[model samples]
Target: MGLNANDRAIASFTMAGHALVHWFETSIPIFLVVWLAEFDVGVALFGIVVALGYAPFGIGALPGGILADRYGTKRLIVLCLGGMSAAFLVLSLATSIYAIAIGLVLWGAAASVYHPAGLALISTGVEERGTVFAWHGIAGNAGIALGPFVAATLLIFLEWSLVAAVLAVPGVIAVLYGLSAEFNPTAAVEEDVDAGPDEALSLSEFVSNSRALFASAFAVIFLIVAVEGLYYRGMLTYLPEILHGLAAIEGLVVPAGLEGIEPADYIYVGLLVVGMGGQYVGGKLTDRIAPARGLLAIFAVLAVLALAFVPVTGMGLAAIAVLCGVFGFFLFAIQPFYQNAVAVYTPADTRGLSYGYTYLGEFGLGSASIAIGGFVLGEWSLTAFFGMIAAVAITGALISVALLAGLDRFIDTDRSVNANADD
Candidate 1:
């Protein structure tokens, strides 16, 4: 079905918000290379510094959700956009590693709110949830791919500080667009029930709501999100560096005048570009199949990919590129599955809170992979780093199996109980 005016507006705004969030997020890894050289820090220590920003980006989602629930998504999203832009501006001015960490912390705190607020808006406002999600994921992956492309491209011409400043401009523009866009945040929910204006919850009420959410199948979904985060953060944080070390990658020819650009950077961006297709395919599958089943297969594929990545590097460049593309596809394909699972398992009233916890597991707990990946890469071999990644994906696959078997039964029983109570 075609989207009406409301759905279009929400999709547009949320798409912009989604893209901007990842634009800032994925760009940081590109910056990580520069930081290591400029600051003269070890990989392990620098990984921890990077984690400071990303942890808050994930950790702040809980409170960001509460704020989205209470104050409304539009306001929180605007704040998120504004905060991210300001943080990058701070990064542009930083003169030391300490200053860079502070800027990242600021950026993380600001960017953390976008997923909860934007996803909740889509969950509660948009009429066609699955389609919008596909587009949403596509936009996010666009930013994911483009952030590094843009950052790397600009770094060749401009200084890192100027590139950081230039990157901040889009967020500011998105903030302006957000302020002017208007749509009913709970239009979808209002059709089924009277989802009135959200009210602030007291501390006790907040605790009760959170407990109830955790008591449901959402708890398992949270575990899946955490492991997914670990694999994602751990793998992507140093992938460019890893690729740079590959003989096949470094041996590739670059077009003239762009010698400043790394071939591995292009490979990294191409992988993310392929992920856009994965996001769309995964989002559409949610409308047709059980998201849990899709996740089961996707996670298993991710595990296989993780285990095979190191081995693939020894192959020719074409082989490496193809494997990376496939890996990128499955890596992002799991997002919409878990995202849809959150909406399906939880109540409409607490959509923001549910997504908040969803991302908390994703970004918050997942941030640890940065440090872990860095340590493994510095002290051990690429084989060791990927083994850990494979382990995380295996964990996700197992959890998906458990979720399908257990949560399905629990949901049925819970629904029957609710029906009896209503009767």
Candidate 2:
């Protein structure tokens, strides 16, 4: 079915918001290479410093969710966009590593709100959530693809600071657009909309609700998210550097005018471009099939790809590119499935908090990759790094298998309880 005017507008704005927020988040890795040269720091130090930014991105999700639940999703989203724009402007003006670190922290704090707020909006606001989420994931991948591409391309011709400032322009536009857009923020329960913050769950009630969620199969879902986070952050955080090292082994070079650009940059961007399609397919599959079954298939693929990436790098550029496409496809494809999974597993009234915790695992625990990447690259072999990533993926896949088995039982149990309560 075609989207009506409201669906189109909400999806477009929300997706645009998703793209711009991610654009800033993903572009930082590209800048890390530049920072290493400018700051003359080791990989470990850079990783730790950058991880500071990443940690806040994760840590802030709880508060961001609470705020979203209290105030409204749209307000926090606008705050996110406006705050990120200012943070980038600060990043542009940085004169030292300290300043850069501060900017990154600010960016992290600002960026933190987006996932909870934006996803909450989509979950509550849109009727055809699967399709909208697919499109949203596609938009996010577009940013993921282009952020590095744009940053890499600009670094060749412009200063890094200037490029950051230039990138900030889009966020400004997004904020303006968000302010003017008339979109609905639907609550999971209609009465919840009229209820004030006072009516939100009390501390003990919140704890009880969380316990109920965790006691069921949703606990397995959270574990899967955590494992996926480790792999996701670890692999992507240092991907360009890893690829660059591989290129150096083969003595690869780019053409003139693309000087200073590494083969990894192109490959990384291309891989993410392929992820756009993955997002669409994953979204479609989650809607059309069972999410757990689909998740199992994708996580299996991710495990294989993580292990294969290093081995494939030795085979030459063509093989590496193909591996990247496959890797990127499965990596991103799993997202919408798991996101939809969260919505299904939890009660709707607490979805913002659920996503808050979901991302807390995905981003909070996921932030470990920064330190993991730093230490692995600084002290260990590339084999060890990929090995750890492979292990993480396999572990996640195992948990997902458990989730698949138990999903129906837990969901049915919850429904029966709710039905009995109604009667």
Candidate 3:
């Protein structure tokens, strides 16, 4: 069905927001490579520094969700965009590692609010949830791919600091666009008793609401995403550096005067570009199949891919590139499944809070993988790194199985209760 004018506005606003959030996010790994060379810091220590920023990106989601639930999604999103831009501007002026860390922290805190606010807005406002999510994921993948592509391309002509400053420009424009855009944030949920933002929650009320949320299937969903996050952050954080060191890639020559470009950077971007397809497919599947069932299969595929990554790299560049593309496809494909699962398992009123905890698991606890990946790569082999991430994917798959089983039991019990009542 065609989206109404309001739905179209909401989708457009969110697509832009999702793209901007990921643009900064995916570009950070490129920056990580530069920081290693520029600051001459050890991998483990710098990983911790990077984590300092990402930790807040996930940790702040809870409160960000709370704020979205109180004041509304649009305001929090506007704050997010402005804060992210300012953070990058700060990074442009940094002269030391500590200053860089501070800028990243600001960026994390600002970008942290987006998932909850944007996803909640879509969940509650858009009449067509699945289609919007597909488009949203595609937009995010565009940022994921283009962020590194743009950052790398810019580095060819500009200094790193200037590139950082230039990166801030898009966010400012997005903030202005966000301010001018208009839509009904509660259009889809208006019929529900709990439609729209609510009064501020007291500390006790907050705790109670949280407890209620976790006591249901969402707790399992949280665990699943947390493991997924561990795999995601661990793998992607160091992938470019890992790829840079590969024999095949290292053996390739850059065209003259384009020496600044790393082949690994574009390869990384290519993987993400393929993820746009994965996102579209995954989003569509949500309407056709049980989300947990899809998650179970996807996680299983991820486990195999993770295990095969290192061995496949030995076959040649083409083989590894295909592997990376497939990995990227399934990697992002998991998002819409988990996102839809959150919407299915949680309440309408607490939609913002649910996504907050969802990201808290996905990004917060998952942020630890950054440090873990650094330590593993520093102390161990690429084989070890892939082995560890493979284990994480396996864990996610197991959890998906458990969630599916639980859901089936719940459905059966519900049917039994209805039949007994009728009797």
Candidate 4:
């Protein structure tokens, strides 16, 4: 079935919201590292500051999910966007670490409210959930991709204070668009999503419906998320620094302190940016292939690439960039697989809580990983940071493989029992 005009409008709003949210969220760090130097904060204090900003996205997931379920996703998204805008506006006035942390906490908490409700909205609204997930991935990656470039470019002319103000502009647009838009379930899907018995958005009655959602597949996905959380938050902390080191030969001027960031750092982050294209492609592939097979293969690639990253420099950085794109593409691209799996295996009533609790591991505990990255950065060298990231990647891959094996057994047993009942 084709998406009606209304469904397209909702999805478009959702997509725009995702883009603005991440654009503001991710770009903060690229400049913050430089910003901290002016305050004379050392590496340890800087790590804590970064953690304050980064950890909240994960921490707020459960509440965000509940909010999505209780109110409407559309409402939660509007509030979150508005809150995020306010937070950034506040950041413009921040002079001390505490003041900035206060702004970050608001931003993190507000930003956290969007994903589960908004994503759940897509799952319910769209006719083709797979394609919705793909578009969701693309929107997120676009935010991911654009954030650094925007941050870097603005730093060239605007003061960091103004940059913070600049980042808030998109949030205002997102909020306005979200508030003005009417949510039509069909936006995310071209099929009969509204015809489902349990499609109603009543959160109060959703308790019984939520339990079957905590399946082994979700547990496996969370294991994978925790690993990637560690890798992404920690290893990515050094991308600009690493690129600046390598780009010396390429004659890219590195950030002299914070003010001198070169085009290559922007370019390197842009490589991760190119990943949206790959993820869009990967999300389409997810619809065609079994997620277990696709996810396992991609995680394996990540383990190898993370290990190979150490020696990767110069043109080798190009190779690293390609693989990094592959890694980010599939790493997140597999999200809808787990999301749809939860929808398929669980009762519709419980999907919200299921999403809420499951994300406790994937998003909640996932927040803790940022703290770990901070710990590592505070205590260890760049080598130690990369080493830990690779180790987490290996751990994630192994956990996924084990989960896949168990899932195979569960599927076989279920099939056998159903066959006997038919007989």
What TM-score number comes out for model 4? 0.82
Output the better candidate (2/4) by TM-score: 2
Q: What lDDT tens digits, residue by residue, belong to model 3 across residues 123-187?
A: 77898776787688778888888888899889788888999989889999999999999999988
Model 2 lDDT-worst window of ten = 414-423
**Candidate 4 lDDT, 243-359, residue by residue in tens:** 555643355445666555555556557666666655666656755765566666766776676666666653554565665566556555555555444444333334446556655
Error of 2 at 419 (Å): 16
Q: Quote model 2's TM-score.
A: 0.90
lDDT of 2 by residue, 249-274 (tens): 34876677766666677888888888
Least lDDT summed over 10 consecutive residues: which range in candidate 1?
A: 414-423
Q: Over the full model, what C-alpha lDDT does candidate 3 score relative to the true structure?
A: 0.84
- The local lDDT score (0 to 100) that residue 237 gets in candidate 1 is 89
Candidate 1 residue lDDT tens string, 1-423? 899889999999999999999999999998988888888778888888899999999999988877887888899999999999999999999999899999999999999988888887887888887678767877888889899999988988989999999999999999999999989888887866454447766799878778777766777878988999999999888998888889997887879987788778788888989888888788778777786898899989999998898789898999998999998888888887887776677643454567788889999999999998888888898999999999999899899999878765664224112211111
Where does candidate 2 stray beyond 4 Å?
1-5, 127-131, 187-192, 196-200, 248-250, 287-289, 405-423
Which scores higher on lDDT, 2 or 4? 2
Indicate whether candidate 1 or candidate 4 has the larger lDDT.
1
Ranking by lDDT: 1, 3, 2, 4
Model 1 / residue 418 / CA error / Å:
13
RMSD of each: 3.3, 3.4, 3.9, 5.2
The superposed Cα distance between candidate 1 and the true structure at residue 242, in angstroms, equals: 0.8
